[model samples]
Target: MRVCLIASGSKGNAVYLQSGESRILVDAGFAARELSRRLELIGVEAQSLDAVFVSHEHGDHCRGLGPLARRYQLPVYMNPETFQALPSLGRVADLHHFDTGSAFTCRDLHVETIPLTHDAARPVAYVVETREGRIGIATDLGIATRLVRERLKGCRVLILEANHDETMLRDGPYPWPLKHRIRGNHGHLSNGDCADLLGDLLWDGLETVFLAHMSETNNRAELALECVQRVLEKQNLCRPQIVVGRQSESSICVSL
Candidate 1:
């Protein structure tokens, strides 16, 4: 299994996953042209993707979905509510709708969709089963629910959210309502929240961790990494390589 975070952060978010003979994308946030360029940076071609799985209807997660699918004629999988929320995505040639919490196969990969607490109509997170093990792609979630913890257990690679720093968010330049929403139960996770959740999901086989979906305004990549590193240092059980996902470029590809 190989995973590359093509782009991450509030500006746009996309992930590339390849397992066996299957090459899939978790989201298509950037415009088709920019997305293509980022894929090329990671040595992946937009035309080579087998399918795209959407986690929600947020622009940073699905802005390029319409053009990408239309141009490439790719299969798009999302829950019915999310499909409905994306009315602007007119006539994607192939559409596969699955209920949240359902499991589906995309060629060589088996994907288990888990419901997420977010502002979108129907957000979801994916756990893809590969020959090497499982790769969990979960971000944009506010609270790490019990179901998320259970489903993400034993994953070899985890792309988790560490969106912001609590103090920075409280004192940031954003308005009150926006700040409150971001700190709410259905908003993005803070660095402290991410570390707490990571402590719960640690295991002997957890080889890699990607701290994704960071806030460019309220949080720095170094702060996010240090927060998680502190948690890892407290315990000697799990010591996975941590990679911070960036909005401007692709992360180092993790092949397991």
Candidate 2:
């Protein structure tokens, strides 16, 4: 199994995954052209994607779903509420709806949808199992629930969200209400929150950790990395290969 963070940030987000003959995209937040360009950067052809699994209806998560799915004639999978929220994607020819907390198969990949806490219509995170190992994707989430931690356990590669730094968020330029929303239980996770969650989820088999969906204004990659590293150090845990996902380029493709 292979995983590549094609792009991740407030601007847009997408993840590419390949297992055996199956190729899938977890999100297509960028425009169709931009998604194609990013996939090309990673040596993947856009037309070769088998399907797209949406995590939510937010523009930064599903903005390109309509055009991208239609252009490639790809099937899109998401919960009914998310599908309803994305009215623009109604024209997609092969839209498939699955309930949250359900497990489904997409070609060679086995996917389990874990419900997420976010200010969106039925947001979800995915735990994908391949022959090599399990890969968990938990982003665009507020608090990491116990279920999220349990579902993500034993993953060989974990793509987790470290959206903001608490101090930077409080001191940043955003207005009071926006800041409150971001710090609220239904908002994105802070670096501290991410670190705390990782402390509980870490296990011997977890080899790679990708810190994703960082805020351009409220978080710096170095700060996010430092926070997680501090937690690991305090626990006297062996550090994994931690990679920070950037908005402009693809992360190194990690294979298991």
lDDT top scorer: 1
Model 2 bad stretches (over 4 Å): none
Q: What's the count of clashing pairs in each model shown?
A: 0, 0
Clashing pairs in 1: none
Candidate 2, poorest ten consecutive residues by summed lDDT: 231-240
Error of model 2, residue 23, in angstroms: 0.5
What do the candidate models score in CA lDDT, each in turn?
0.94, 0.92
Clash pairs, candidate 2, are none
Which residue ranges in model 1 land beyond 4 Å of their true spot?
Answer: none
How much lDDT does candidate 1 score?
Answer: 0.94
Q: Write candidate 1's Cα lDDT for 178-229 as tens digits.
A: 9999999999999999999999999999999999999999999888988999
